[model samples]
Target: MTPSRELWVVLETLHDVTYFTPEARAANESAGLRGFWRGYVATRAAPLGAAGLGLVTAVFHNFAPSFLARSLPSVWEKVSPERALAARLEGAVAALRAHLPEPPARANELLRRAMDGLCWDGRPLGAANAVLPWPDEPTAALWHAATALREHRGDGHVAVLVSEGVSGLEAHVLRDAADGSRELIMPNRGWTDEQWTDAERNLWARGLLDGGGLTDEGNRLREHIEHRTDALATYDLTEAEFAELDGQLRPAARVLVPGAVPHPNPVGTPRP
Candidate 1:
């Protein structure tokens, strides 16, 4: 099949590789992003803030909005930029150490080069620019590289969603159906039953969904999103580099592929 263009494996692998790096979790909590918000919201103070919910959500995908809603806004109250970048970097560095402990000598170089290749002019649209002013660290640099690339794809994704006429929540609903999973994003994402019903009606009326499920067209559209996302994500890399990256990244991902940790597959990356 000349490898899949959807690159779903590569996409999930990269996202999972970064997110599941055990130390990243520890770093986030110790730094107070997770602990401050989830552990004790009252303790979150003025100095610890972020850009906004949308920026946070786009970069930090796979998190439930309700969970994000709790900590993000409180943290985003004042918007201290450097600290925000460091908080995310901490976990990624930890994961890199835990995973790529041996020196590729040029791993950071590879990541940084790719990061430099990203186009980040999307101020109103993407999350990468939020930390544009910050300097890069080696292992942490990998995370920033991935974050920038991922957010670029994300910005393009929102454009695609709008182009397809799929509303935000409706896109989520359609994804779940197209992927054959029925889990709602979390009741805390600020959607009501009526709103959801209305989304369903719109999808059904347009024949994208049918009989309480995604129709063939729905699956096609969802697949289109997935493929387009992968294409955008890998846009900066050559085929050889991407193949090498996919191989290099799969090991860290494999560590967490099964029942490997406390939350078990928290990154939600499937095995290749």
Candidate 2:
């Protein structure tokens, strides 16, 4: 399929997911979806051409500070398959880099390192061990937090720690309002300290934290998360290929924009 058509299909897929994922639609509600979407179409108009950017632009119109943080990874989950997620993510990087007049290869290299740290040698749900009530939630939550950190600071370990507010994320999720605290969203239930601790330790081991804050590896991971998010947003898919591409891009796409179903809690909520 042509690049223009691919972008149109991607937009449609994003719209379907947006409506399908209630949280995603609700989040867009606050952002004035229609107006925000118009801006993106206007900006990417040249690349979008006759078909325009379509739903992809509307779904991702807001472009808020934390928008991509929670969206890309989730989107990837819906689009890609378990086995090919990593390679698809690499494809996203390639597509985005091509779009840039002078791409930063160093940054891309750093992104791969970050991805390695998250994917557990390229395995799906390879992040921190299962700690939340639901089994599948931790990966997405952890990724969202990591994405936030990467966007705040451009993959600099020190910058990630200082600006990202590691403790704050835990506390925010847990509803404790304390720094250095972590909470696992219980989907339908509530929070649990046991699960939080496990997540904390796992994140620490994965270099999401250190004695002071985010470790060097954590910073690298954050860089990869941010880069991937941008790539997904910049990437496109054709109408016919959307379903086919979805299976391959699931993991990284979701990593790029986490807009999936009721993500399970890794700590305590009863599993279905």
Candidate 3:
């Protein structure tokens, strides 16, 4: 992987503590978001300030719309977007403090620099997050920076998927087939068995899948999408800067993998 991609993997682990950790979930529940899915949707989408279903569906780009409708707007009704953001940050900071070593001062500074250079055009999630006030605590600031960069990469990935004519469900279908994780991905993203079968048929029509796995054409398209995503995620950091950031974050990521963050996760983040 390129340095940019490697950075993304490690940083993603850091950012994801807000989603997967007990502390984050507890915070969400305490804030009046009742269930896991409701908490998940509210915390993640809170940065968008009470976003409606269509906007969330378009930017998030992978969840089943019906699944989102189950929580959104209603989630906002239960807890304001501002409160949701605070809850997630509180949980993420608590989780980081419990798990990782204190990040080096320089590491946090590098992440801030990376955030400063982030290009926000067409990156709705990233743009919204970038505008939030940085936390006073070092750990919170680090997580916030990581979250912004992660979403920036995510928004770019969504763009690549759109450009490739891959719908959210189709993206999951292709990903599961390529990575051998259909069982985990299908239910996590709320795609029905019928929807999955139909997506597979669509891919077959496109010559992207067969009984065994991804056809050669399917493999090529997947690779292309990933490469383009990497290109878009590449920040203005030097090779040396990326190396420094990776060295700092990789240890914490290793600690989180399979403990806080699961391997073969629905988010598609690999173990660092």
Candidate 4:
């Protein structure tokens, strides 16, 4: 994919906007979503929730499984996953409404109209689009839009990762290398020493790493995937429109990001 300033601006800015969304965070926490999702997993027939969040597992793949395990642990009998998730969404969208009035009317109009121009074939709709329940509140609608778009980029990213031959665990390991951090991912992923070693061994064979860590080629490959992911996400917008979208979201991001600290700050996001 060709380089695109517009794509990076739109993708990264909107992504950070969601991360900083006090509404969703407040809702997720208040609803005890950790327990909800964990409980959802605990209740499922085959432990599918424990199977991790599908594509999301990769985005958060570097974190130790223990952290996720603790937050979304096995507690099946207490609650239904559906009920818990709904509670979280309701409360969070309420906050979004409180923070920004009429999000659906304006934010939705701008972003969704832009979205309408894109091709949706073959792309899997994720949690954000599981339902078409558009809230009357504008900020809630904006949050919904953000989730859908971010998930779109994320789904595309997984395809890129798969095409490039990076497994879930291997993607985790290689990213750890690129970040120059050994301490962050190893234990979190719940892999035994043997598991970690094998992942690195595979990475070595791929010529993406060496004794010193991520080789130059590895760095470039990581960067390329991210670039491709961003470009893929902005497929619907012209350079000017993407910039307009970024400009629209930046002030809101600025207001919300600071109070939204102690986030995971994964290697992929540049420091705001």
TM-score of each: 0.71, 0.23, 0.97, 0.71
Best by TM-score: 3
Candidate 4: clashing pairs of residues: 64-188, 64-189, 65-188, 102-138, 103-138, 103-139, 104-138
Q: Please give the distance, in angstroms, between residue 137's alpha carbon in candidate 2 and its true position after superposition.
A: 35
Residue-wise C-alpha lDDT for candidate 3, range 143-174, written one tens digit per residue: 99889999999999999999999998998889
Model 2 lDDT, residue 190, Cα: 29
List of clashing residue pairs for candidate 1:
24-91, 49-75, 50-76
Q: Residues 1-272, candidate 4: write the lDDT tens digits.
A: 34234434333543443334555455445545443334223222111232344433444434445545554434323435554555445654555444444332244666676556665544564333524466565665665566556556666777788778887677777777766544655554556678778989998998999998889988888898877776666645556655566666655544444454223443244433
lDDT by residue (tens digit), candidate 2, 1-272: 33322322332322222222433333333333323222222222211222222332332222222333333333323322221222222222333222222322232233233344332221112121111122133333323232322222222222223344443234233232222223333221222455556646766665666666666766675555444434423222334444444343333333323333223322111111
The Cα local distance difference test for each model comes to: 0.53, 0.32, 0.88, 0.54
**Best lDDT among the predictions, by candidate number:** 3
Each candidate structure's count of clashing pairs:
3, 47, 0, 7
Give the 10-residue window scoring lowest on summed lDDT in candidate 1.
Answer: 39-48
- Tens-digit per-residue lDDT, 132-191, candidate 1: 543455555554554555556666667667668777778767866655433435353455
